[model samples]
Target: MQKLDRAWLDRHPLPSPAIGGDKNARGRVLVVGGAEFVPGALRLTGEAVLRAGAGKLQMATVRAAAMSLAVLMPEAAMIALPADDDGEIASGAIELLGERLANCDTLVLGPGMSASERTEQLVAALLRGASAGQTIVLDAAALTCAGNLGTLVAAHEGRVIMTPHYGEMAYLTGIDAETIANDPVAAAERVAEKFNAIVVLKGARTVLAGAGEEAALFEGGSAGLATSGSGDVLAGVIGGIAARGAVPFTAAGWGVFIHGAAGEHAAKEIAEIGFLARDLLPAIPKLIANFGAG
Candidate 1:
């Protein structure tokens, strides 16, 4: 296992900006998530994507909430997907998202989504339809279907990344949460190999693993990061980084490190356990810029 730290980041710099490039040059990110009851979750993810340096953003969510979400997030171009009775994006969204999925440099899935058969179908279809080089970041309910669709995930080669907490990891791997928590690194590696994707096993001490023995560890975050929507921010950060040209493992390692560091920074300003998830957003660009400077 390797420690992911500032020194480690220095050795592996982010992609440098072009001398004269437009927003398109920075890359585009498409974030597909949110339900009527949890539209804010998708907004958080979309904002974090831009905060992490992706230039253009597209947010696809339940059609009912699209207009409101667009007003809340003016930076993102909104794509309203058909919604099921439960307000979840419907399986039919795959057709609406095909061109967007193909066009985006990175696709971030599952923030504020619920688990259901409809969700499973939507997730599977999206996973199967992602373009060859597009980076895919899966989190929350999107992960519930991943374990059953190994071939679809593996089709992307190493271009996919999954962020799952202990419970979510268990859901993806069919292992009990206790066993996974006992040795997360091993469990993360196992999942990564099984799906042929990079796995960010999030917890107090997050473990990022890719196919084979590759693994990186981050333990810098504080308890403040345990709040709701924090994982959404982390997913967006990773997706944005990937959109900007970092490989899956590189983006995961950096995203985990920055996220934890933001937690530590927030803890210093606010109480360790009281800071909101959105509090971590402002620190993101500052952290990235600091690394870019040195």
Candidate 2:
């Protein structure tokens, strides 16, 4: 892992006018996640993506959850997935996702998903179908499911962003959190190089890694972001920025800052524990503007 310090982030803020005067100019994000019991992941992701500046946000989820989410999250244009007997997405969901990905600039996968057979099928197909320049932010389960990290990178280089906390990172790399905690950059770079995608090793200081560039650590935010669905929100934020056509490392950096700053602001009124993951929504605009990242 490459050594990185805070100075690098102070130099590279996210670009402004995220999009031009047209709809296509602003990026579209397709978020694929949600199951019978965890449909909220899709809703949280869709909301977070839009809050972070994705012009158009689509939610692809099992048909069982579509109606509830459509009503709860009106902002998200929902794509109803074909489900199997267990109410989980079936292989047929891949076709629906493929159709959506054809029009989207990015994919945020595995937010509230279970390790169902069909879910695995759809995720595998996505890893196979994803191409260069199209960003894929794999969080939670999807990150772990792609067991053979090298093949994932070979499938699409510089297109994957794996957001893993200590446990997931330990599980994926066979390194304990203590070892990784002492040297997160090294762990981040090892996995990033293994998969050929930038890795956002989420923690006290988020580290970003990609091709050729030495890693950069973004230090900010608070424990308020350490909630249940916060990781899902982070994935959506990264996907939203990716929709803007920013490079993987830059996008991850911006996302880390945006989310952390949002958490910090949201905590002021909502109390660190009082505020939920979704509460970070209202803080996004000001956080973006205040950071001079615009």
Candidate 3:
């Protein structure tokens, strides 16, 4: 596996904005997922994507969480999905999402969503409906909801990127968490080859792999990144980068580095133990600025 060092990151800078370009020039991103009970998850993700330089943002969430999430993230246009009695996004919401899918350059799925049969149905529908050339970043419950991830990802023609922690990776690959933890690069690469999509197996040192590409590893984040909603932030950063035209593997690599760098910044300020996930948001722009400066 190749190590993602500062030099490598500096070489792969994010797309620079044009002098007279409008918001659309940076790229449009749609984040789809958020339940009533976990409204903060998608909100964190949305904010992270904006901070990571996505030009326009849209959020598609459950009806109950829509208004509040909109208030939390005024920058993103909000789309309320139909909800079932349990406050989960209903299967029927697929039609509403289909109407908006073509408008976005990137689709971020699964943050803050509940894992259920309904969620599986929704994921399946979205996967089937996703257009060619649109990037898909899957995280949290979306990873678990898919009944046949390989088939779904293959159907997308390798445009999908999945972010799974050890446990989620176990569920997706049927490899026990312990085995995955022992050698994450191998596990991530195997899953990447099987699914024909980019696989980001998140941990202390994240591993990234995709079909026909060399595996890469990043080791820089602090324990501050272990907090809740942190993975959502990572997903958002990657989605934003992908929306701005980075390929799946490049987006994942850059996202992993930026997340780890932001974690280090947050840890230095608040100390690793007490820093919250939101603390990482403010650090993102500064890191990007430093990248630009270098």
* Best by the lDDT measure: 1
List clash counts for every candidate, in order. 0, 0, 0
Clash count, predicted structure 3: 0
**Per-prediction TM-score:** 0.97, 0.91, 0.96
Candidate 2 residue-wise lDDT, 1-294, digit = tens: 323324444566665663235655768888988888787888778888887777888888888899999999887788998877766677877776777887888989889876655565677899777767788998877877765545855568677888989887897799999999999889988888777878889998888877566787767788788888888888988888888767778778878878887887887787866679888877776665666533
lDDT of each: 0.90, 0.79, 0.87
Candidate 1: tens digits of C-alpha lDDT, residues 1-294 = 778888778866899877788988888999999999898999889999999999899999999999999999999999999998888888899899989988889999999898888888888888888778889998898877677788999899988899999998888878999999899998999889988999999999999899964588887999989999999999999999888889888898889988898899999999899999999999999999887676
Which window of ten consecutive residues has the lowest lDDT sum in model 2?
A: 1-10
lDDT of 3 at 217: 86
User: Better model by lDDT, 1 or 3?
Assistant: 1
Per-model root-mean-square deviation over C-alphas: 1.1, 2.4, 1.3
Give me the runs in candidate 1 sitting further than 4 Å from their true place.
none
